[model samples]
Target chain A: MSTLPLISCRGLKKIYPLSGVEVHALRGVDLDIERGEMVAIMGPSGSGKSTLMNIIGCMDLQTQGSYYFDGVNTSDLDARELAALRNKKLGFVFQRYNLLPRASALYNVEIPLFYSGMYGEEVKNRALAALSRFGIDELADNLPNQLSGGQQQRVAIARAVVNDPLVVLADEPTGALDTTNSLEVMNILQKMHIEQGVTIIIITHEPEIAGFCPRKLIMRDGKIISNEISSSDVRSKEV
Target chain B: MSVRFRVLSSFSIDALKANKMRSFLTMLGVIIGVAAVILMMSIGQGAQQQVLSRINSLGSNLLTVMPGAAGQFVRSGNVNTLTLKDAQAIAKLTGVARVAPTVRGNTLATCGNKTWTTEISGTTQEIADISSLEVELGRFFSETDVAGISSVAVIGQTVYENLFDAGVDPVGSEIRLSGISFKVIGLLKSLGASSGGPDRDDTIYIPVTTAQIRLLGKTDQSVNQIQVQVQDLNQMGTVQDEITSLLRKRHRLSDQADDDFNIRNITQLQTAAQNVTGILTLFLAGVAMISLIVGGIGIMNIMLVSVTERTREIGLRMAVGANKQDILNQFLYEAILLSLTGSFFGIVFGIAGSKIFSHFAKWSTAISIQAVVLSVAFALIVGVFFGYYPARRASRLNPAEALSFE
Candidate 1:
């Protein structure tokens, strides 16, 4: 790994179209996330971090400025290109876990593989492998509601990373879980970063949750207020 | 397209599984519509067949030349005449097999206190052979009676029952009609009813000369109508053509002048009847197609509701890299699958309905294979057509907004 930034945004802007008005969701944003780095984005509601996370995830297009993912200029990409990038490179985890209701854990994990252009038994094998990695293979036949909140988030994470994407973008992955479940989910994200060498981004307003990431990006009033080391792990590794 | 179709079928199966009751109800609409088409076609076909058979019982090779025109009002005092000479000329033509002159009228006949009102027809022995008659008693009027104007009559089955209440031998008995007496020659076998509602077996066949001279007041006049039979059934049309032209020439009419006679061929009439029934069947099938369209609309509606319900799923799929085309393909496939399933059930229902209708309603049904194929194809097209907008709406949805929806 040459330490190339997996995701870099320059002067990003997001303007919400209201009824005969423009709501400035993000005036400008600049971000850099290197490969193998675990980053946390912290902000209060309406601080534009959600908007920033959306842009980084390629779930929504920006109104202005450029974003680069794996050296490819994302701002210039069309809708199809954005979809391809999302499937091939980025995995998403929402606060609700966002597993398809009534779908089995195996099927939930197989979703990306289904869309990843994989065919036949390969999709099933890959999905099974991904579920086993998260230790949810035993619950592969269980529905989302059948699993515990923490287990559901683990299944969601397995689903997100099944395509072996460049990054796991989790937006408050533990927001709906209890303290114990939240800790379990945070540990899962940490394992993906530390053990599997997968770059991970966690967006949250809690410093305690942000403490688990090696790097933290804090946002306030549509701007990055702090971009600094949050843990001693990355420094020790660097030395 | 294959992937699209697979996705569509899967979604349709899911919809059916999720809302089994609604899916079944939707299928009912298509079933009724398809059934209606076949039912209507069968009824029309049955009527047409009845008409054709009625004409067939009249003998396939017979042709009748009437002096009255269709759709024209006749002046009562001015009688339209078709001479017996014209009948002779037609009888001499190359394809002519037989010819008979006839006059029709009503009169009272009495034999020993048994009196009845009946039709008295004046014709020769050829009438017996051409009309497929079987003599119940005695014998038919002969050539000698026709040539010599013998006062003899052959009564039908109904005339025998009414006039012979005494159980006397009708073959040798004398009957008085219109104050004129005639010896019974023979009795005709039954021939049921004609399309005109007159009992064919109720008429009395009298020698033409005797009918003109003894019973009615016509002492000397050309025969009123002539029935010509051709050598072969197929030659009837050509013979009729020749007869018409000959009649026109005999009448010394101008080129523009309309002929005073009408030549009706039973086969031609039967063909016309068949055509009418065929058209009616097609029209019924067409009406059924409309119901199928309505059924397709039903499928579209349910699919649209399904798409709305699965908005979040759509968003999730989009996030997982499903493009607009993929989304479009998925929903479109869903629509087509629904209609195809409906079509399958519709065909089953249509056949069953037709069978039940024919048995209960006494209708005749002919289930054409083409109808099934056309119906299936139509349903699929309808699924696609009606399903298009909803599928498009689903594909056009923004992932962010959809994901946020409950």
Candidate 2:
């Protein structure tokens, strides 16, 4: 494929006006992520790792930076264009599993495809296939409330990859899970990366969760302080 | 776009179904408002129809000439201003078809053991044709009876019913009117009570000359009123103008003086009554519209609550790929569906309510297609008007903040 980075950022900064005072959520930062890479952004609460994730997910604009996704400048996109880009190119997973509480797992997986303008039997078949891939096909008709945390996360992952987006952003995907479920979810993410070559980014404050990724970026005070490739054989041990 | 709309509508339906009780409560306002509008309109229309029909029974292209100025109350002593000669002169006009000079007085009539006080109407045979009176049992008095001043009468249905027993033929019978024995020659057909007016069938018809000479003991040939029939409806205004000028000239009235006689067009009275009922209908509909607006406010209130309650869901949908327009459409469709369904039931209840009211109140009621269509259109407008604010609010929500919202 093209020898270009899938996501590139330069001097990204984000500030919020809270009760008449400027709160700096993000400082100038530069980062690059290539295709087929699994990266983790590690930081505690108020460290602005979530802010960076929000910007990278195209849900918010950086105050003073240029963000490029798949070589396209996100700063140049309008609100509608950003939504379209998110729909067609990116997927998201939240710590809460973020599945629609009222909708069945199958319908939740079909949401991205619906926004991408695919409908009818094709949408249904693709959603079913994604659910089966995540081993939740039998629970496709279950609502989010009816499923366990691990099953709900699997449904969320199925939905994130249902449209085969360019990248999947998981912000604290294991934050609300037990250790057994967290490890299982991490293994699934690893298998998705190694087998399907889907780019994955996980944001977490736990070192154990960060250790599951091949590359980890540590953040402090809205600035990325370190970027290192871990030699740990956690993937082989987990898979 | 169509497929997207379908999906959005389905989403709206699901949301509404999730809170069935709340949705129904929100729709209750619209239902009551529409039903009230329809019932009021039907009542107004029914009253107007009853009035027009009663006026129609008096005869088409007909005018009544009273003794005083229009809208002025005339005393019994002033009732003799219109004379038989004036009526004869009116009949000789180009557009005039027939004229019947009449004098009426209430008198007690005795038949066997029954005695009822009824009106005695003195007129010529032309009244039969002008008033469209039918002879149920025998023919009306002939011209020979008028010339001879014979004390023969044609009894109306109400007078006959009151003076005679059930199934008893009053024709060829004798009844004492105001101490004068008169032979009944005919029986007039029954005419139901006129709308809010006196019972027209409670009168006895006799020769005008006989009443003036024998009963009234009047030496003059003056009469109380004159009923004139016109040949054509289009010639009514011309004929009325001609008669006014003729009466003014005959009465020797000056240029500045108002005419002594008052001419009333039956059609004009009908038109004025129709206009009044039309206004009543509009007024009633307006009041009902206020209720509909209140219902719209109820919808807006519920929609606002729904938007707030589903903020997290909206954020999730946006994260999955829903744009602002999609969210707006979903909420708008919900409002529209609520109002439309409410209006449907409103129409049903309105028609049934009107029927029940008319049955119990003994008043006629008419429901028009225009009314139904108007209400449906009005409901749709209300839905859109009230639905817009909440939908826009939901669509404008910030996805990032919304997702993080508790």
Candidate 3:
């Protein structure tokens, strides 16, 4: 594999103006992640982990940063260009599943495809194939509310990977799930990273949840305190 | 792009259907506004048409020469400015088809013990053709009768019912007019009521010479009015001008002085009535347009509430790669669908309401296609105008803050 990183950020900083006072959410952070790597970010609340995730996801602009995704400078893109990049190259999974309550599972999985200009039976077949990867294709016609927490999460995962994005950023993906559902979700993420060569980044406060990844970064006071690689999960086999 | 548009529309439709009652209530204002516009325009159009047709039914090429100055508000009864010689002079004009000098009086008619008082009009034989009068039972008196000063009368339908027995022929019967015995020679057809408040069927016609010599007892050749018919309606203005000049010259009136007579083309009154109706319709539509604006405001209010309620959904879509324009298109499409559906139902109701109004009020109503098309276009514009703000508000939301909102 090439040595170029999938994501690289240098001296990233974020500040918010609140009530005529400046609140520094992130002072400066530097990070790098290789392709096909499964990584986790660990932090307590208000530790700026969420802020970093938002900037890396292209949903927001950092106050001061030099960030590159696949060697393209993010600051060079406009709002619409950022949206197109998000549509084509990135995916996200949230803890709450964030599924449209009224839409069927099949339609929920089809959201990214819809934005990518895909139509007709190709869209349906791709969404169905994504759902089948998680063994929930039979529940495609069911609404989000009709499924269990585990099934809903699986559908959300199906949606996140339906477009075969370059990287998947999950924010507290297992936070709202029970132990059984959480383990099942983490296993699915692991399988997606290993089998499909998809780079994965999961944020969590739980050490056991972070244990599922091969590498983990701990953040405090808007700065990275530790970056550790687990000795047992040396499973970086390229596809 | 079209596929994305389809997706957005489906999302809009689904959202609207989720709250069916709210959607319908939001549409109510547009419905009523469009219906009112249609109803008002139809009523105005129908009244104008009816008035014109009534005036036309009197006679298409007819003009009345009244004994007053034009545009005068008040006048004394029976000015005696017109005479039979003036009618003869007008009849000699180039485009005059017929001229009848008219004399009017009120007197009691008695046949046996029954007596009823009614109006009496005196004219020559040309009055029948000029006024569109028909003899239902008998014949009109001849012009020779007028020349000989014969005391022959034609009783109208109302007079026949009042003075003569029912199912009995009144022609050739004698009826005393103000104690002067006259032969009833004909029964005039029923002409119904004029909009000017006169019962046209209640009059009796006699020879102008007879009325002047015997009944009215007038020494001079004065007449109440003159009725003139022209060969063509388009020539009425020229004929009127010619008669004015001729009369002015004969009367020896100067240019600075107003003439003592007024010549009214019935078509002018028809046009005036039409103008009044048109103004009334425009006024009503203006009021209805206010309500349509109010309805648009109602749509705006609901869309604002919808945007607030669906904040989380908007955040989710944005996170999933939907852009600002996508969010805008979704909400805008929802609002447009609501208003357009309301307009469709409003058109159906407007037509039905016009029919019901005409049936109940005994008024004529005609729905115009122009009104329908204009109102629909207006309603669509209202939807877009009102829906734009709320959709913009939705599109401008911060995805991070919106997602974190409860």
Candidate 4:
């Protein structure tokens, strides 16, 4: 087994100009996530949890920092390299599901594979398999609008994991769902981490949802305030 | 890795299909622009064709020697400047094939009880050959008729129709021109009315000597114009220069003076007509291109709006691993597809429009394959030119900010 962590960040800083004033979304943060670890980040609005997710997803670059993913320094990579890294190694689930409204559920799942330059029948079969893994293969042809909130979230999850990425980042993945739907979504993420040995990170304010993960990190004002490992009973009981 | 052409196209097609009405409206401008270009080109070419055929029919190798300086308007009293002797001199030139001097006068003709006013042209038998005029009923007046000054005439189709009943045989009949009775020896074939020109079939032909003595009351052998046919088309310029110097010498004009007669080359007139029509066609095409540009602007406008409306989708795609180039290609393909499809229907509409126009306007129109190809090429250029800006804007969008955009 590789001793190097899947994700390693040190002194990460992101300063953006908003209306001519410098706003520090992420100020000097450090973190490490090992392979096959399931963690949850809890924070209020403007606490930089979303900023951290964006950086980890390879969708943005830190103004000042070094990010190492899979033993490669991400700070030295260009935009195209970052995009390739994102396509091959990272998966993302949004708060709103963000399934393309006009695309079929199967097509939504095929997007990551398509961007990774895999096409034809193989892409279709793999997308179908991902949908089947989430038990939504019957809804493959249905558009996002035709599916319920929980079903749509399931489709989004299937899309994120379709390429078997090294890490799955869920940013308020169940924010729009009811308590029952939220628990169901968390259950699927937990199942994927345990069964497939996939690393999963969920960002949420709900302690009930965060309880599903083995590790929880709470953030405030652009820094992690608490990092704790909850008892196995809290994680196992939720599943 | 870049997306495949097929995949990009399918993505754009789906996006276009999702908003059917908006896509159609965006294409409407290109359709109208292409149609206008085609229709205008057809009309301009039709006019050129008509002019060329008309001039060709009058004889391509022929020149008209009018009794006035070139580009100067001639009054009716200026008829004495060119005479039959000048026509004889021109006929003797090396490149000249035939010459027919003619005098024209508008006179009333009365046959039986019917009276109609028409133009009377006095010329020799060579006029029939030079003008390519065929006799439908009887032979044209013979050379003997001109030498003897016989009171014989050849009636045109329009004059015959006006002076006598339709069923009547006007040949071997008598018609009075300016109160002078003449025997109708032949009937000229109908040449039909030319656009914006005089009716060619509404005139009468008679022996020049007879007209000079009996009707025109001219003691001298003065004629209005001389028609000359050249043996070869290539010798037109040399022959024209020869005629100019000969007329100047015969008229006793000094070296500094312009010749009293104007030698108009039929080929030069044809070329000038072609140039005019070419400019007209270009002007029309330019106007149509402006509309095409406007259509391109319309595409840019809608694409900008589309980028804005689909910001969240773009963000999502980027998050899922799409780079700037992928996003750029997607939107570019959409714009190109809209223009290409619009141009296709535009070609159909243009062809149909020209056909309908020609049918009702009594004008001829021809749609060239080049015009179709050119419009399509222009549409493609427009698509690429206008689509680039919006696509770049979409591609430059920051994924994180875009994802959070409402």
Candidate 5:
């Protein structure tokens, strides 16, 4: 890999003004994540984890910051350019799975590829491959509401990596699942990391969820207080 | 970009299908508006055509001079101040081609065991040329018959049908009129119902001399109306002025006497009627356009609701890779599809509705291809105009806020 970090940010800050009162969500956050690293950001409510995720995902503009993805500065891009950058380089998974209610799982998985300029039968094939990788290709034609929670998250993950994005940012990927389904989803992410060398950043408040990631960052009051690397690989195949 | 647009359009159609009933209800306004406008426009055009055709039958480049001032209270054909001498004087005017003096009287005619009441128009041989009256079979009165007061007549089509067999020639047949047996010398072709006037085919023509002295028993040389044919249509006004001056001089009428005559320019009246019909059509179309606007508003209303309801979906699409333009295109296509679909059905129903209306209402309706094209084009304009705001609103949404929205 290149010497430059895969994800880097300096002096990131986000502020919101509500009816004349200033609410600072993130204050002077600085971090660097290397390539092929599976990391988890663990923080309680109002800890700015989701805000940081949104900024890193290029879905929102930062009030004051410099962010670089794969060594390209993000602060210099316009809205359309930022969208293009996100389309080509980044993928996101939300806590709720955020699949279009009207589309089938296969179409949901094809969304990122569509943005990445894939067309027709090729897009369908890539989407099917991603769905099968998660062992949920049989449910590809089912809508989000038709699938179980675990199946829905599998479809969401399939969508997140369909374009082979440089980094996948999943916020609370297993937040809505029971313990049995949660472990199943964590195993898929683990398989993606080891087999495909995909970089992933998952945000969660559960310690159990954080334990699955090799590296964990604990945040409090909009700042990371601790960054830990565990030597023991947590491998429990529940599927 | 083209592929993206295709996908977006398909998604728009899918979105519309998701709320099938709402989309259809939104399109209802456009359908009714287009149908009503086209129907009224066609009917108005048909009426104008009918009036113009009726007026054409009176002959081209012709003018009528009657005895009194024309007004709402002044009825034609009763003024007795006009005379055959005045007609003769007008006939001599420069630019006047021919003149036919007419003295009309309702008379009863009996042939064999049949009797029918028809107007007897006492006119000279020039009446045929001045009034576009054609002799379908046999011949009109010769100059010998008119000058000699011969008791010969030409029967109109309705008169021939009433007094004789359908296919039998009535030319050589003799019929008794006011107890006088006059030989029918000609058969005039049919002239159907005019604008609001009596059917021309229901009249019988006789020599003016015979009707004045032998049948009606009038000593005064008076005529009801004089039909004058001008040499050129462009010289009508000058010919009319010349006739007015000649008649005034011959009658020894003073300047204040109002000419004791009225000149009717049939073509002028036709043009005036055409203009009135055109304005009426425009007025009706304007009212119908109001309904189209209302229909567009209905589309706007529903699209706004749809955009708001699908906020989360929009957010998800943006998160995946869609830009603002993609969202805008998808919503705009939905609106356009609804209006265009409504317009198609509107055109079909408009044509069929006009046919049904004409059949039962006894009013003529002509569906012009321009109207169909214009309605469809206008419907497209309405779709773009009303659908833009909602689509823009959907596009301007912040993806982060939208995805988080419930």
Candidate 6:
């Protein structure tokens, strides 16, 4: 594998402005991940793990930092540029699924395609292919409210992968589910990383959830405390 | 997404449907406002037209002389200081059609066992010709009575009924105005009441010379007014100039000084009445729009609440690559859509209400195209005006805090 990183961070810091005060969310963080690497972030409450994730996901700007995504430096990028990069190079999955309440599973997956301005049968084909790959293709017409928590999570995963983004970013994707459901989500994430050769990054406090990732990183007091390589569990060569 | 209007339009429709009762209430405001404008304008227009037709009935092309500092005057009912010679001179003018000398005053008339009070006018054969006095019994006072100052008279239907004890033909019957006996020679047609319910038939007429020499004897050379008629409408300006110069020279008023008399065409009065209706309609429309403004406020309140309720949804959108402008546009689209739908229903109600009112009012009503167009535009504008603040607040939400919002 090339030594060049798909995502690189240098001296990233986040300070929030409160009334007559300032809140330091992230302090002096430096990190990187190679292309096609699967990593998990573990942190306690108020550890600024979510803040770091927001910055990395391009949903927020770092107060002081340099972030290079796929070799393009994001220091001077505007809000529009951040959204564009997030749409094309990054994907997000949340614990609550966050599918549009009025839309069906298929429509939820097609939202990324709408932003990309892909028209005609092409958007449908790509959206259907993404859902079918996750084995939720038969439930494509069901609304998020009509689906089970695990099924909704599966739909969210399909939505994340619809654009074939460079990195899949998940924030406690299985935090609201049962153990069986949690394992099912982890298994899907592992299969996508290995089979599709896509980079994956997940944020969670659970050690077992981190165990499913090929690498693990822990944060405390807004600082990364440990970074370690974990055993890659290649559960399937096909399927 | 490609064509911004279509996307925004669909979203607005959804907003309108989501709050059915609120949307209907907003529409009600618009309906009442627009309908009032139409109704007020129609009534005003109808009344003005009726007055104009009455004035025209007095003479085909009459010009009334009013007392003014100059030629500019608006009212036809005001008393003036013009006389019999002025009428004669106006008739002799190059573009003159004809002229009628008129003397009007309030007086008490009495016959045997009957006494009635009403307006009394002393006029000539020209007045009879111009006023279209139908001879229901005997002939109107002729040139003989005017020239010879005979005591012959013509009476309106209302005066004949109230003042005459002898129901027989009033022709040759005697009556006294200020105690001078005059023979009633003719009866006028029943012109009915004016729109305000004043009895137009409650009056009497006699030859100008007879009233001047016998009844309303006075040394003042000036008669009350002179009614002049032009041959055609296009000849009015020339006749007006001739009358102006004549009056100015007679009164010895210089070019720099204003004339003591004013000349007005009935057409101008008609136009002025039309303008009054137009202004009334505009004022009513302005008042009605207040309700629409209130409706817009309701929309803003609801939108603000919606933004607060969907904070986490906004955060999710931002995280999924939606920008501030996109979010702003989304809410604005909803606002415009709600208002547009309201305006549509308002138009429907306004037209229906106007139709129902016109039948009862007995007035000719026409829906103004400008009012309809302006109201719809205003409703949409109200949407944009009131819808902006909440949408801006939504777009300005902090992503981190919003995401963490429960």
Model number with the top TM-score: 6
The estimated TM-scores of all candidates read 0.87, 0.84, 0.85, 0.84, 0.77, 0.91
Across B290-401, the per-residue lDDT of candidate 4 in tens digits comes to 8989999999999999999999999999988988888999999999999999899889999999999999999999798878888889988999999999999999998998
Candidate 3 docking quality: incorrect, acceptable, medium or high? medium
Task: For candidate 2, write residues B1-406 as lDDT tens digits.
Answer: 9989888898899899889999999999989878888888888889888878877877869988888877787673466678878988998999899999898788899998899999989999999999888999988998899989999999999998899888987888999999899999999998777757889899999999998888877667888889999999999999999999999988889999987889989888888988988898889888988888888889999999999999999988888888899889999999999889889988998999999999999999999887888887898899999999999999999888888889
The CA root-mean-square deviation of candidate 5, after full C-alpha superposition on the true structure, stands at: 6.6
Estimate, for each residue in A34-94, the C-alpha lDDT of model 3 and write its tens digit.
8898899998888899889988888888899888988888999987778788887888899
Q: Which scores greater on TM-score, model 1 or model 4?
A: 1
Let me know the TM-score candidate 5 reaches against the reference structure: 0.77
Model 6 has a DockQ score of 0.52
As for TM-score, the candidate ahead, 3 or 6, is: 6
Question: TM-score of the A chain in candidate 4?
Answer: 0.97
Q: What is candidate 5's lDDT per residue for B77-113, written digit by digit as tens? A: 5567788888888887889899998888889998898
Off by over 4 Å in 1: A1-6, A18-22, A71-77, A195-197, A231-239, B68-81, B108-118, B157-170, B194-196, B213-224, B245-260, B286-290
Residue pairs with clashing backbones, model 2: none
In order, the interface RMSDs are 1.8, 1.0, 1.1, 1.2, 1.3, 2.2
Candidate 6 chain B worst ten-residue window by lDDT: B71-80
Question: What is candidate 4's TM-score against the reference?
Answer: 0.84
| Residue-wise C-alpha lDDT for candidate 4, range A1-239, written one tens digit per residue | 26668989899999988999999988888999999999999989999999999999888889998888898888888878888887878899988999899999999999888888888999999999999998999999999999999999999999999889989999999899999999899989988898999999999989889989889998888888899987757887765
Query: What range of 10 consecutive residues in model 4 chain B has the weakest lDDT sum?
Result: B1-10
Worst ten-residue run, lDDT, model 1 chain B? B70-79
Candidate 2's DockQ: 0.59
DockQ class, candidate 6: medium
Clashes of each: 2, 0, 0, 0, 0, 0
Model 3 chain A: which ten-residue window has the lowest total lDDT? A230-239
